[model samples]
Target: MTDLASFPELLAGYFEIPIDEPGAKAVSDPYGSVRVDVGVIRQEVRSPGYLVSGLVYDVSTGLVESVVAPTQVPTG
Candidate 1:
């Protein structure tokens, strides 16, 4: 089973294509597909680490939603 805790990292990596390649549009997984909107990625700094968040437009529902919580990586 896929651990729920790893979803943030999984989603963060899944968005890599669209983030790197400007021409990229959509992506797919076992659940479904979503249109990547690189502009929505948000980042913020916290005390012990930083958080990066992003959202995707669902192809089926046509609604934007967060696939995972902001990924938090400790700096120390």
Candidate 2:
């Protein structure tokens, strides 16, 4: 909730999720617990907005594979 803004790199990677098996999962990091899925993000993306932020996970084990944050984004 409050810490959702901590990881932007992993979230950005989801932007490249294959169009077929976009995954969904809950991750616990410095930002607390979050429910995320590239599929959902793809379905509901609002550009000109803040970059995404969260951790990625394995669809089967729910193990965090990586942390993602935009790190930096073009402001134009």
Candidate 3:
């Protein structure tokens, strides 16, 4: 497995964004959630929107356990 510290660089490369351009935005899970740094790399869109994807790293374990993608929600 790759080092958790390198996730930001990996994400930057995957998204074709500059590593030094503040590409990765840090996020967090709900309260009582596991300790992890959630880095979101939003999908670039022409208009304003919320579509995004990211990686989850376990802070205690120093490992990346999963990649997350946006899920569709039914609209009324």
Candidate 4:
């Protein structure tokens, strides 16, 4: 995992699903209440809305598989 020590420059943003609570099981989750990891934990002051190039990680894993980039369009 990359060091988030620099912040903003290292880890720009984060976002997540609106589950009932953190670590809430998805079994009871509604359709739109699900989202991937790295919820907007930080933001870049300089870039405004641009997510810092590469600053994300999965806490729910011992080894991450992939990162699903946010899309302007939602999936069906």
Candidate 5:
């Protein structure tokens, strides 16, 4: 397991699937309640946006996987 404290330069950012996108529909009573977070772990502030980069740890394999690569996301 890697310690998150090792990368002080990185900031935590949560990325979720857009509500309007497919597969974001609610499974229960409330419509559009089932939002999913892609789980972006760290990013770098780039003024107008953030440089998104993150990894997912698979407990089944006990390995780290890269889900979201370095990409720029607009804040607006």
Candidate 6:
């Protein structure tokens, strides 16, 4: 509901990592209640030549409720 400006700080606290070290790759809490996946794509023809993305999943519901990328963030 907010913006990416606050995402790193939030993720860091939830994962107990440094703000600059969210380790945004595939990660989940010890209890498996929350899961996060960071995705990257590379293409020579693309505008930026690459892309970075993230997804937050609810393990219990097996649903992806949030998605974030360098350009946008959409929640369900």
Please count the clashing residue pairs in each candidate, in the order shown. 0, 8, 0, 6, 0, 0
Give the per-residue lDDT digits (tens) of candidate 2, residues 10-71.
54355454333222233333223333444355346655655655565565787874454543
Q: Which consecutive 10 residues in model 2 have the weakest lDDT in total?
A: 22-31
- Write one digit per residue (lDDT tens) for candidate 5, span 1-76: 1342233233122123343332232222121221123222222243465566555656688988665566675453
Model 3, position 69, has a per-residue lDDT of: 55
Among these predictions, the greatest TM-score belongs to: 5
| Tens digit per residue, CA lDDT, model 3, 19-53 | 76322332123221222222222222333444444
User: Where is model 6 more than 4 Å wrong at Cα?
Assistant: 1-48, 70-76
Q: Write the per-residue lDDT of candidate 1 for residues 20-72, one digit (tens) a residue.
A: 44223323342223223322332223345556556565668898887555666
lDDT of 4 at 59: 65
lDDT of 6 by residue, 1-76 (tens): 1233357777777767788876453333421222233322322224443445545656688987545544432222
TM-score of each: 0.29, 0.25, 0.24, 0.19, 0.33, 0.28
Write down the lDDT of every candidate, Cα atoms only.
0.43, 0.44, 0.41, 0.31, 0.38, 0.46
**Would you list the rank order by TM-score, best first?**
5, 1, 6, 2, 3, 4
Q: If both were scored by TM-score, which would come out higher, candidate 3 or candidate 4?
A: 3
Query: Candidate 5, clashing residue pairs?
Result: none
> Candidate 1: lDDT over CA atoms?
0.43
- Per-residue lDDT, model 6, residue 70, is 47
- Off-target runs (Cα >4 Å) in candidate 2 are 1-39, 56-66, 71-76
Model 6 has an lDDT value of 0.46
* Best-to-worst ranking by lDDT: 6, 2, 1, 3, 5, 4
Better of 4 and 5 by TM-score: 5
